[model samples]
Target: MLKWQWRQGIVTLFFVAVGLLLAILVGYSQPAFRSADSGSLSARSGVKIEYPVAEIKTGLPLPSDRTEVQMAAACLPPQRTPTALSFQAKLVTPEPSRAVPKYKPQQRQEKVHPTNYGNRMQRDVHHRRVNNELLVVLHETVGDAHGAISTFQTPHYDDDNQVSYHAVISRNGTVIYLVPANKRAYGAGNSEFIGINGVEAVQTNPSLASSVNNFAYHISLETPVDGLLDDHPEHSGYTQKQYQSLAWLIARTGVATSRITTHAAIDREGARQDPRSFSFPKLLSYLNQYPRPTEIPPCPLPPQG
Candidate 1:
């Protein structure tokens, strides 16, 4: 009986030892926990806190330190704007396009010159085949319209010394008809042309003198009073009236705005500097609004001798 009692006590001691070992092992395996506020132990105990993906990205409850927050923000991408949120929004609200301005055409009297005033012939007179009546050459008449008309009208005693243009615009914007619309007007002498259609080798080669008079329609603006009076005249700018009449004349020529150019631009001699201070932008703006003929009128038949 004594031996059996002793065996039961030994077995009880062994069981307690095994239980202590297991408790120690369980404590070691579990992570340690501490409460930030001892009063809210229940709130912290055995509860896991996890931040959401959105919170992680946005950094919700941002840091109080401005410098720290700025540093953190620097690492993040810029916030998208309403326009950036979707490309379609940008397309829906596109920037405005450039617009041309409006203008009224100026009316003027025609003091027509006689057929003798202008030389007879087509564009190809001196290999002057300026076909298509395409180019609108800008020139500044060194003298007034009256003088220009007289010069054109007078059958030059020496025809070789004669020069003429199609139309002349006075300082007051009066458009004077000098030469017939489609006739060669000797407007741009020693001029060269490289039209949009391709190189006119025969017309513009350096070796051969390029004269646009064949294909070009010349419009001369009367020099400003000061422009002509000043011996060493500079570009005395044109008046508003001049611009209006010039624009109208260009529209009449039945040519594209691209076809309009300056004598200085096409001149090979470089001595020609007419139509000073041309308002190209203003002219182009008005051209958009003005109506034009589909084609240049054919030259009137030379008056029967």
Candidate 2:
């Protein structure tokens, strides 16, 4: 009876030991519980652990002595913006246009000079051969409209010995008519076009031809009396009235803003300086709002001093 009792005890002990061994094997092969204090406590072949949530909620306390977050932030690039942590919300809106004065086309008191008006015979010849681009070179009338127009007209009497331009601006924002926009004017000196002669060359250049429709136009703005009195020394800084008129004139020219270039830009080596006091950013701002033209005119402006 004692021996039988002992055998029963031994069998019970063996079963208990086997159960514990099976439990340990299962735990070792499967993912286990995650603890709050020490990230996830998982048992797998090759396991990865995430950072403790508690550390994130309250930024980990900096070390007590000489505490610097440098070690923790070392892997990150320096932030340039102060508001980097702020939520971004974009607001797209249209900009308003600046005020502009009115422009009235002037009626020449003296029958516009014979040279100023296009010759009937000359017009017929150029009409068929005209291109679609106009190399617009802006100039500051060193003199008023009257003196400028007169100089271009009376070649023999003028001191510069020769002069010519397509149009002129009077002091009161009046646009004086001269040669037709379609006709070539003797503005730029010793200038050549990419595929044509002189000012017309700009029209012929492939790059310039493309910009003609978007960023270029032709107009001669009249500087204030000071510009003329001092031989247009101050013409670089033109008047608000003339600028207003020029903006309007360019709109009418059907040229693109991109194609509009200063005389100085085109003529690397020349004696023309016009549209003095030009503001590139201001002009670019104006052009950005305007549309490009479809037709490319063949006429171009000359380089100036």
Instruction: Give the TM-score of each candidate.
Output: 0.53, 0.45
Q: Worst ten-residue run, lDDT, model 2?
A: 80-89
State how far residue 229 of model 2 sits from its true place (Å): 5.7
Please list the residue runs of candidate 2 whose C-alpha ends up more than 4 Å from where it truly belongs after superposition: 1-132, 155-160, 192-218, 229-236, 284-291, 294-305
Deviation in Å, model 2, residue 134 alpha carbon: 1.6
**Candidate 2 per-residue lDDT over residues 25-133, each given as its tens digit:** 9889863443333555432323332322212222333222211222222212222111111211121122225433344344342223444222212112224222333
RMSD of each: 28.2, 22.8
**Model 2 residue 289 lDDT score:** 49
Candidate 1 positional error at 122, Å: 6.0
Deviation in angstroms for 297 in model 2? 20
Error of 1 at 301 (Å): 45
